[model samples]
Target: MTRRPATPLPPLEERRRLREAGSLTPDQLAARLGVAIGTVRAWESGRTTPRGRNREAYAKLLAALAESPTRTGAPGSAPAGGPEEPDAAVVAVGPAKTVSGGRRGRAAAKPSAFTQTPPPSSPFLPFLPFSPFSPRVPSWAPPEEEDPLGPVSDLTPVQAFDALYSFCAPSLVRQAYLLTGRRGLARESVERAFQLAWERWPEVARDPDPAGWVRAAAHEWALSPWHRFRPRHRRPEPPLSDASDRALLKVVLRLPPSYRRALLLHDGVGLGLPDTAAETEASTPATAGRLLHARRAIAARLPELSDPRVLHRRLAELASTEPLRTAGPPAARDGCERRARFWTRFALAFVAVLLGTTALSLRTPPAGHEPSVPPGETVRDVPPRVAPGPLSEKQRKLRAKLREELLHGPERLAPQPR
Candidate 1:
């Protein structure tokens, strides 16, 4: 049977962009394509190239997405892919209601005070063709002036990541510093966290709290015991200028790790009790206990800072005073890509080693199976003989002598019946 040729696909990077433009997640695309989500990931990441039917289907889907521009807003507005059409694009919605042609309708149609003119074309609406006399785009429309809290989700993957990093990095770095008492470690932790977030950007982007996701990762990295063995982390950073701040930090560090974490998340970060508990992966009561125990430990050493309010204020001051900063988003992204490539190469080398071992085994001659022989002697045949015939002459003579002796001996040794 003749097989149909697979459809040609675009560049690996473009495949991902098309999917993102369509706002279709890997899971959504996988479901549509009847393939595992990992397979979709491999295809997009260039780990595995699709073939046969899968290649055709995936290429077709991405081609459709590429053809349909995601930026266009509505039906009447000019399609983003096409050129501007001022006259054809006019969309006057909600026009006045027409009356039936009758005398009563004509009388009813008469203008009343309640009657209003049709709403003027909205200046914000993209469909409107305006004059040079019309007001220029507002100053607030600049990208930098965009409302940080407003939804800016219709973006390419990289742009969305930059927005997230810009929004979350400053506070995240400070939080990492508070977790680890070193500014350098804090900066490294936040930077590494962003690298990890970029590495798993799709999952991070879909998360409900992307900031929290990065925060958890940064805190984990900052608090890692492995950091103690590193040459850089073995030595402590320079102390804070304020003696009281140093003392407070020392008392905090002295607390059990869990308790210190709870205190920081709850009091320092201003997270709600439940949120602190969730982030710390403990129950509400357990987190409260840790938090209380930490606070009490601090109070023991520094009674003057006993009040929760005072402690919270002091902790915030200490965290804020640290000179922790993160690398730019683009730099972080490039580093993440480099790290990913390194691991990918490492894995390929490992697999190649395994395959080489298998090939070597196949080429080598196998040992033959040999049965073991015991150390005990082996009896080999010498001759077959009839043993009884040779002794017959000597046996007859002895038998006759023995009969005579037996008769004599009975007579000599026993009393006769007579």
Candidate 2:
């Protein structure tokens, strides 16, 4: 009797499904079979079919893997491959014999910890209605529910400000301190600038350089005269054993604010010339000049500090003397709320003034004109003006004939019926 031929194994897709059922990635399968990743990819993509020895080995590997039990069960525990049985029991039968079946069986079969079902909602917690307007949910929460306010990438004003504040506050305070030479004043300036930022957050957050806006505001506030009245607390100058370093600091403090700001923002804060110019509100060329002049001034005062390395070190030392003071998140939030309220009131008042002016303008009559008639009303027509000159002979004859026709009818003026 002739031996029955073996049925041809399933296609590459079926093979891939078997591999996936065995919890293996394509790369893992390729490595185990000692073939290039591209070869596996080609097989899966149907670009090329495995042949000869490769095909035979691949078929056997898939069959063995399909029959092998997953990590959740003992070897050869799973039934031979066919359509997955819905009621298959997924018993975790180690020391603990928990018999989870049905839909839970599939979830229990997964080896990955991430696939575990979450615990049921706590009974003690009150059931709160889900608000569409709620703020962002935590990262660990299931993502089945859609967010009404959209993704976090389109950040709200408060979130944007908070992110900016956390990122830039320390650097801004240090930059401000270098400008003002007073640590307390620097902190105050930075805080006030952040407050302004929070007020205009809708605009600032959308700017290409939110940090630049804050830096500019801090620069302006640090130089303002209001700080003078606030009781001055003299911070002890950090000891400079080298006379040249002390002299350098003195010269930097003495230079014009523009030059000083340019130097500190560029050299000290490590911002580029264009960013410095933006923060200083000057053209790039002007900013370059300020930096040039500042360098020349420092060089002239202390030639030893002219070297870039020395300058950088000296600036670092100076800035390092005072630690940056970051405002608490709560304080920042309160300031933002306060500024928001102020702007809200100001906007309403401005709108009110505009509306009142419009109403009054509508009510007042136009100059050199009486009250205009309503659109639907009709006015009597004016009589046409008579010509000033006396009537000519033709006009006189026409007028006499018209009067004769009016008095004796047309037949009397028509040479009678004849």
Best by lDDT: 1
Instruction: Enumerate residue pairs that collide in model 2.
Output: none
Candidate 1 ranges beyond 4 A from true positions: 1-152, 366-418
lDDT of 1 by residue, 1-418 (tens): 5333335566543565466546676799999999998788667544366877887788789878767744222243355575332110011101112335532223223321111111234222211111111212221122232331123334567766776676567767766666777888878888899899988887887665566788889888888889888998878688988787789878887877678788877766545566778898999999989988888888999997788756764665566555566789899899999999999999999999999999999989668867789688754432344575655666668667667765644445567696
Worst 10 residues of 2 by lDDT: 123-132
Clashing pairs in 1: none
The alpha-carbon deviation from the true structure for residue 381 of candidate 1, after best TM-score superposition, in angstroms, is 20
Q: What is the C-alpha lDDT profile of model 2 across 108-226, one tens digit per residue?
A: 34321111111234210111111111323322233434542123333455555665665567666766777777767888888988888776766775564455667789889987756
RMSD of 2: 25.6
Where in model 2 is the C-alpha error above 4 Å?
Answer: 1-156, 225-246, 339-418
In terms of TM-score, the best-performing candidate is 1
